[model samples]
Target chain A: MEIKQIAEELVSLVREGKNKEAKEKFYSADIISIEGNGDKVEGIAAVYEKSNAWMSQIAEVHSASVTDPLVAADHFAIGIKMDITYKNGYRAVLDEIGVYDVNDGKIVAEQFFFKS
Target chain B: MEIKQIAEELVSLVREGKNKEAKEKFYSADIISIEGNGDKVEGIAAVYEKSNAWMSQIAEVHSASVTDPLVAADHFAIGIKMDITYKNGYRAVLDEIGVYDVNDGKIVAEQFFFKS
Candidate 1:
């Protein structure tokens, strides 16, 4: 699949609360996600755990969208503006850009940046 | 040139206050550095300006080293821990993983992370 399609699909699954589908679509077996915060979840299982914890706190992922999406070879990157509204009407504003390293149709690694 | 060599050289130039050499070595004619803090310096010239401001406030960049440096095709990325010591003895500890999207041998896009 084209990187654009992959990126959109993966993010869609995530925002739609399709956890299993998002993980299966977005990551490789050995995918490495370097958490933006030092508390990275190491591997896939850990990612799931952290994600579950997040879900436990928040009702859902409010929205995930990107702009300035650029693709070079096997990498796809974009600037993102997100709102993850919590259960209590409070929201966290995240302005970031994510870079995904893809290989053989799967994302093998990802890095995220948070705006200060 | 190996990305490892390039990463080390570029970072060294930045740390050593060799602005000209570092800029010459790492960026293209139209490089874009997303301020990691949202005040992105759109082009190479802007990058130099923001960087200058940083240096003006800080005494020096203490160190830059990467672990798990990886390269596939035209991209390079790694985890970083840095200390920027200010003239006033205050310091900022930046623990980040940067993913660089290189094109035609130059880094066109760079995303940075800050661990919470």
Candidate 2:
């Protein structure tokens, strides 16, 4: 699959609540996703743990669409707008820019930032 | 200047407290910066206003380095870590991915996101 396609799929899976599958399919053994942890998550085991935390959050992402997905030779960036519903009957809107490094048909690194 | 060089310079200008010079040097008249405002700031005037707000915040970005700056034909993503020390004796650390759209030798669009 094209790198862009994979990226789309990963987000799709997560949006669909298929967090495990999404995590499994998109990440490499040396995968590094710079997340809210303030540090990088390395290796499959670590990524799985990260996925667990990410999935357990009481939230629903109403929309996840790519805006201005700029693709290069081996890298691409996808800007996304996400409407998340929290457990406290509160809703948060998050806009994110996700930068990915695809190597050997797998995502090696990803850094995501949200608007607020 | 090379696109990367321009990117570096613009960021440098801002870091050095030369916000006006940096904004003047890098942005086009129709510049659009998708900032924390949740809406796009259009035109050079709007961008300048945005810059004013950005420059007014009391903070010190201890480190701003590019991590895996993926440069494509028209887009590039830079992951930046900022250590902001507020005047109220509070520190807010932000890790952001800034995506820029350069057209006609100037920044026509930019989007920024933080880890939090």
Candidate 3:
């Protein structure tokens, strides 16, 4: 798949709340994921565990959105916004840009940028 | 200056090739700038030196463009594309997403995401 196709599919899956499916379909086995605060996790399994842990803490999701990607070369970026309440009674709005790198038709890396 | 105003003015200055002026007008004195390759520099003066060093190596700029910002909260992201030839006879097209964090009307941090 081309970068644009992968980007579109990834965004579509994410917007539809199929983040796990999207990762399974597009992410490389040794994918590296980095958070805004500099936490880094390598490999698909580690990434999934990290994501699942976060999901388990979410009490409710009020709203969410993934913007159209800005595609450039083998890289693409999208803006993501989410309003949610955690199980601990913490409600917050999360806004960030997710940048992805595609190589040999697979997503090799994803790094997020935001103000914490 | 509100986030919107600062964002607009910064984009305008960058579009006009007045990056130094933009930094002076919109960036905090202790701004942190991180490159796509994970090189982090603290302070505006250090950032300026790094930028100037890169600029001095560019033989010619064929084209450059900055996309309209995607603003969310006190953060914003923009796509930047540049085609250039270096003094060492190397030519390349650079594409990246720049994410900025604004605080008290000044841009306190910026990070670039790109594939090396």
What lDDT tens digits, residue by residue, belong to model 1 across residues B19-114? 578677878878867644545667888878877777788887777544544443455555566678899989886655566666666777666644
> Model 1 off-target regions past 4 Å?
A1-116, B1-5, B8-20, B60-64
Candidate 2 residues lying further than 4 Å off, grouped into runs, are A1-24, A27-116, B11-19, B59-68
Clashing pairs in 1: none
Weakest ten-residue segment in model 3 chain A by summed lDDT: A69-78
List TM-score per model, in order: 0.46, 0.48, 0.93
Better of 2 and 3 by TM-score: 3
Query: Any runs in candidate 3 off by more than 4 Å, and if so which?
Result: none
Cα-based lDDT for every prediction = 0.65, 0.67, 0.90
Better of 1 and 3 by TM-score: 3
Chain B alone, TM-score, model 1 = 0.73
Best by lDDT: 3
Candidate 1 C-alpha lDDT tens digits along A43-107 = 67776776677777775566765553445445655555666888887888666556777777788
Q: Once all C-alphas are superposed, what RMSD does model 3 give against the true structure?
A: 1.6
Please name the candidate that would achieve the greatest TM-score relative to the true structure: 3
